[model samples]
Target: MSKDQVLDPGAIAARLADLPAWKEADGWIVRTYRTHSWKGTLMVINTVGHLAEAAWHHPDLTASYAWVEVRLTTHSAKGLTEKDFALARKIEEVVGWQPGLEGGALEGTPSDPRFAYIKHGR
Candidate 1:
């Protein structure tokens, strides 16, 4: 696939099929990850930054106490390209990552495993 070539509708749809958590909006593919705490939100943002830097494909990120939205598009190519999907896949791999292997998920407690996968309740 050409790195700079913007994908057509059929191609974009086919690629997007694999990314169930993502949707195209306003000429961009986007996904929002929901977390249980501020720590989780921050962790997601940092992880996205690492992925973007590693892939050399940056994305627009909006982060809050319980949510982080990642928007991907290739500005240089002026549209969506293979690079966007590639980076999105990489980002998805660890976006909802629970960092227990790094010794506690969020620096709160190893006992509670920090704030990951917390269920919502009224």
Candidate 2:
């Protein structure tokens, strides 16, 4: 099917299998990223904003002191589409990256609670 076409429940489920943190709900694909503080929340929001803008597909965001929920759908298509899934993957990658785990020169946020940022899943 075309990328812009609305995905059926079966297709959505298959796609979601590749995105463990995301789910289909109320015609949208959603995911919530937990952070350590307001600062981390803002960072998550900004990161998503940049990704959405770059992809030219935006998502609705709900932010709290320590979390940000992203809801994405193809407004024009009136349902979930490839655009939503692609953007979701990009957002997931950037937001969940742990440079420290890669043993790269760039150390991720310090392990100390005071310096912690995103609460990455183990």
Candidate 3:
């Protein structure tokens, strides 16, 4: 819950192996992408719907013709946790987001072409 406490990289890495696109942020994990159009956004949403149902976890999503932003956090944990990291990884796997991208809650740059710009949010 408190950012002051550090999460163990080994344990977190094990849980995050399946999720390559998501990354640890200050308090949460996130991913973002550009959709081809409005319909593409709907398609992405529908895909996430199935993923959410399967994982029984959901993310905060904002979508438009050009972009979709996904943020995952464990509200109950009040900060990053195993659950949050797990979901973050899963989303990345499903969406094909590369790690160390700017879309996460941490600071970094990405060399991928899908994202025009990626950044962390408060």
Candidate 4:
């Protein structure tokens, strides 16, 4: 979808909330993750890289020794949209981190595969 189409906040919020701990501010969706170390963080970044490339949508990423922050917005749209929500969901799925949960799902494990269902959902 073209990024020019703005999304309704109410509808977008409903979808984003289910994507773990993403927050909305200044018309951007933000999520921060803490990794074990620089190596782990890079791994996460690399994984996200492939996902974003495949989706043909990109996020604003900031990474350090142990943390990675992602801010996503449809720049062309000047706001949120189904594309943004969909990307956020994919990211949350791949990273295996959920905001309130005691722990994140196991990455690289065969079970709880979110990507496996993405194509079918579409």
lDDT of all predictions: 0.80, 0.93, 0.60, 0.72
lDDT score of residue 23 within candidate 1: 93
Candidate 2 lDDT over 1-82, as tens digits, reads 7889998888899999999999889999999999999999999999999999999999999999999999999999999999
Clashing pairs in 3: 19-89, 21-97, 102-119
Badly placed stretches (over 4 Å) of model 1 are 97-114, 117-122
> What TM-score fits each model?
0.81, 0.97, 0.57, 0.73
RMSD of each: 4.7, 1.0, 10.3, 8.5
| Candidate 4, backbone clash total | 1
Ordered list by lDDT, greatest first: 2, 1, 4, 3
Tens digits of per-residue lDDT, candidate 4, 79-103, equal 8877788888888777774333454
Report backbone clashes per prediction: 0, 0, 3, 1
Error of 2 at 90 (Å): 0.3
Per-residue CA lDDT of candidate 1, range 19-97, in tens? 9888998889998888778887787788899989988899999987888899999999889999999998888766644
lDDT of 3 by residue, 4-76 (tens): 3335666556655655556656666666666655655665677776787787767788887767777777676
Clashing pairs in 4: 3-77
Q: List the residue pairs that clash in candidate 2.
A: none
Q: How high is the lDDT of residue 3 in model 1? A: 91
Better of 2 and 3 by lDDT: 2
Considering summed lDDT, which 10 consecutive residues are worst modelled in model 4? Answer: 113-122
- Give the local distance difference test score of model 3: 0.60
